[model samples]
Target: MSRHSQVRESSQLQRRLESLNTARELAEGVLPEQELQSVYDVLERAASRRSLSAEHTVVGFFGATGSGKSSLFNAVSGSELATAAARRPTTSAPLAGIWGEDGSGPLLDWLDVKERHTLPPVPGLADEHTGLVLLDLPDFDSTRVENREIVQRMVGMVDVLVWVLDPQKYADAAVHNDFLRPMASHGAVTLVVLNQVDKLSSADASAVMQSLEGILARDGLGQVRVLSASALTGDGVQTLRGAIRNVVVQREATTQRLAADVTRAATELARASGEGEARGIKGNAKARLASELSTAANVPVVVDAVQRSFKRESAKRTGWPVTRWLLRFRPDPLRRLNLGRDDTRPELSRTSLPPAGAPERARTDAAVRDFADDASTGAPGPWRAAIRGVARDGREQLPDALDQAIAGTDLKATKRPLWWVLFNTLQWLALLLAVGGLGWLGVLAVLGYFQMPVPEVPRTEGWPWPTLMVVGGVVLGIVLAISGRMLGGWAARVRASGAAKRLKAAVAAVAEQRIVEPVEVEITRLKAFNAALKAARSG
Candidate 1:
């Protein structure tokens, strides 16, 4: 590869790593940790391996028991570095055969390979095999728990995997199902060799290879390279060496392996998160939730108080002066509930409104559940659960928040209307005129009683002025009081409607802050997480 190509490839790898990190961060609370543990381990292993060496490619030979991996290891390295023992689990620990001396030591140490062999450089093959560090790993199917553990750790840490299979156990389900199927996304850095092919004839060997390839294709590893080799007769050993050499010379195995790891991890996350994007809260759902919350907060009760209070105060201001005092004995509805306009710190003082009953609470909960369901429709199960969880948690704080919202709202019930002032002034003037007329009549009667010459009372249009004042003022004030009562009813309805709107709006705000917003936040997080997984999976 050219220098520019190398730089671009490195940049792509870095971007993939960054995208994976983004997905991991977003998936923390949304996904179960047990489902994401493998991805976490892959990321940690990638970081540790990348920090060590970029030039060396670590390829491990993994297989079941009696797979002749050690024999193949020795044949490829041209030295008896690994013992081809007849025991069940010959390679208890990992053995590293380093073809290059420059940067293999630290990489080997990172791999925790204590038994390392430095191979002598061959004249024509030195350039082809340089920087190759091959590991002979323990059998994955070993009876010893520690041996299986080592294999598992080394499988994730290696840059390339070469599965060696004997003709006898080449079709084993344990290896194919547990190992090969899971590593399907790592086809670029994977190779499967049917080792010990010397035991079969030429035609049988071809048949075995074909059968193994068929099994691999079914395991989602159709693109992986398959080879047949024999360590005993040295058949196809050079071909195997050439394949490993090509990977080393290109120096892209480490990048390819890490990229494959990221792809696999992203695929797992996508599966858990499910498909599709979050459609935000529906308009009808929000409306319904607000309505339900208003009911639960007793907004209607407050609105009724406002209407009755307005009428009572109107009667005090506009009633006939003779009977207006009677209305004062009746208590103001809103004042009785401690929700009157006189309250300056309503939020600090609880209103006398009744607590929400069971039916109100159930309706509120059902409304919240419906809202969350609508917002999370078509989302994955886990994402849906997460959104509902947020909504449920916020529901616990709703009652207090709704009360505070109701108390804080400016209902405008206590404000005096301009018409009331005009009517009040007119009533006082009528009362004074009637009182003056009565006093004049009393003076005339007293003069008649003293047997003096009574003065002729002033008259206008054939009627005494005092008589007209007395009867006309009383009749006009009574008419005005009756008109005021009718108008106050209309104004009371208008004020009640306005107060209902304001109170409902306050309740809606409480619902939004306590429930809707939290659910939306979870939905947004799930969408971002899914997007990040898509980017991580992309080339």
Candidate 2:
């Protein structure tokens, strides 16, 4: 083939493999673990197959429990290598008989065999066979469950399988439905050996082979070679041996089969667009999800919450005197009002941004987490969490999607500003200076009242100097107090604004880190897979 044609063929094959993989994934969802493994194992082997320089063949001795595989094994090797018995499961484990001078290391590894047997080449039985491994595995149609599993697992490892069957059970449902039909894809490497055909008349033997051929054809293993062989009469064992050598030993059938499987598997890989979702969130749904998320904790929502909080604080800070508040707006006995901010904010940082609240930010965060957990009902994990809205409603809990939104984020806060400590210090100093001025003014007034020229008896009280001292102190106190209050208020405003800015930033960051980017990633993956699936389907 030309380079271009080969590339195209390779591409086509890759597509098919991916579709097969997807189908397998679907099948695995419903099938039992063992059965799924059997199907998937073929696909996996198909992937590992590569064109090899020299050929090696594996002829497997596969049959029902009482089909005399051990007898055939001994006959083919021209010696007693396998134990033929009357047990329900004749072969308890796989015993490989390699006819190769080249080490059977890799082949055995592929088959995952722990037990091995070496048989020297006999004149007719193993002639011209440099790389043939005769594998006798446990029976598929056996009462022992492990026997069946062993056979099923080893099937894909062998190149060409020589199925041994007795005349009585050749047409059994267990033989056909359990083994043949499902493996119809491997027709090119399948053969049937009617063991103990000498038990039947020549005509009956021919008739059975004919019928079996027809069944094999229906299963797509048409052209399946059939031979009448018997270990008892030694009738067709030589012919069967020659045939095995022709396919597995001389002709390098195993190598060819492996190449084809490799090509097929490569084709599947080429077709795939790679991992991720099949179909991504799209159209109205994406827009809807995003919109809903924004409504929950969007910029506007958070800003609104902060503003409301500000108004309440303002009313207290600049409103009626503290004494009047104590008498009029005392704490409500019925309501469980929080006096301090809750610790829920730090906890919520585990999965989401801090939640909104009137009093305790921590409590707000907890409520938001609870709400978000409630939102992603059918979705799996933090992957599809609800967008936790800002605390809009006056309720204790945040909207349902906050944790999902938060958990998705990396939760890395930006580095604290370098001047943050300096700024904090300046604010504290300004407040203290104003408070100190208020104390000084109070002391000056008290001293002035006492020293008002009441020293008729002694010089204990002074008039002018004391008045002057009080005047200067009062004037200095007024200026300092006024300036101090202004500076202190300014500092408070700056602090609150900075905090609000950080919060807004944190909220936006949570959206970006958690929900937005992840959704985009999932979308990209799904698109790639979908593209691959489409290409495969096209091919």
Candidate 3:
């Protein structure tokens, strides 16, 4: 390849590698572990192979059991590098044939090839194929399981694949379905050689080549070159040599192979992540969730307590001084609920409110599920499941969080109303007047009984001053007490309504922290994954 082309390839590879890393992180808890690990393995293998030498082009000769790949390996190298036979599974392990001065030791070592051979320079082909490293891999259809495994492992590491097929098995289902079809996108680094074409007449050879080409095209490998050659007769070997030499000279086989692998991986990951974009949760859905959580947290109960507490305090302020102290005998409603007090960390404090019953718990669970479902609408199945999982991740912590929110809320209940203070002062004055009038009457009665001289009492508007003071003070106090009770009821309602609003807001915050936040995080992850995949696939 030209220098500019090589640089472009390197840049694309870097971008693909970065994309793979991002996909790995995003798929951690969402996708199946095995699926993600497979992609990770692909990336690691590609990175390790590239870390070796970039000069040598490692091409493997792969075929089914009687395809004569070992013969073709020898023909390509122009030397007897591997034993060739018509029998099945002749090659057990991979045999490498190097054709350059540079020792591909590290590359072969990474490829795990133990048997090696060096080919002498061909008359006119030595310089062109200098950096080529050819391998005769074991039969992919080997009866021995280990031999088949060796082929499978080497398939991913090789820079290029050259499939050698005999006329009889060129169209074999296993070869086409298992290998050719899957590696379709790797056409730039793939070739197919029809070995043993010498066994057929010229017309038959052409017909067989034509039929194989059709099959390969259906396998999505239409761009892959199909050549007819014979290792035994050395016929058409020159053409195959030219193909391998061009690949070696260009030095793009490795790049194309890695790029194809990345494309396949990215495609698979995108499928697992879903195709649609995340629109996020709807506003009404969040409000409904908050309302449901409030019910479950007993916010209404706390609000009721606040109202009752206000009324009790109001009664103390406006009642007759003689009986105002009686209001204190009863406990404040909000205090009993462990609310209406200042607390630095309400999350740590347990509310005295009643434990949620079965109905409340069920409602909360259903609402959470509904919220996840609504948020995940139009998402893929796996992402929807992940969204639901996120919502429930901190479910056990929710009850405590909600209770803390209620307890930590400032209900404004502690501040007494100014009107209450004014009414209270009047009540105290009235009580004092009644007591003074009684004292005066008692003194006058005692003097009269003792036959001592008694002073005449003052009168106001033709009424005895002491008698008027006693009757008026008593009547005024009774009337004031009755009026205070009516006003206290109205004031209690206003305070309760305000408290309900504040408490609901606190409950909404709790819902956000415990449920909505987690769901949003998953949605964000999905968006990131989608963008990464897009970058990976971008032209």
Candidate whose lDDT is highest:
1
Residues 128-223 of candidate 2 have per-residue lDDT tens digits of 346777888788877888878888877756778788999998888887887777666566677789999878998998999898888878876786
Candidate models: Cα lDDT each? 0.86, 0.55, 0.84
Question: Is candidate 2 or 3 superior in lDDT?
Answer: 3
Q: Each model's TM-score? A: 0.96, 0.49, 0.93
* Stretches > 4 Å off in candidate 2: 1-55, 78-97, 105-125, 142-153, 201-203, 217-220, 230-239, 249-279, 283-285, 298-512, 526-539
Per-residue lDDT tens digits for candidate 1, residues 236-257, read 7888888888887788889899
Segments in model 1 whose C-alpha atoms lie over 4 Å from true places: 84-89, 122-129
Pairs that clash in candidate 3: 1-250
Give one digit per residue, the lDDT tens place, for model 3 in 461-481.
888777877888888888888
lDDT of residue 99 for candidate 2: 71
Stretch of 10 with least lDDT, candidate 3: 122-131
**Model 1 lDDT-worst window of ten:** 120-129
- The Cα error of candidate 3 at residue 116, in Å, is 1.8
**For model 1, what is the error of residue 335's alpha carbon versus the real structure, in angstroms, after optimal superposition?**
1.3
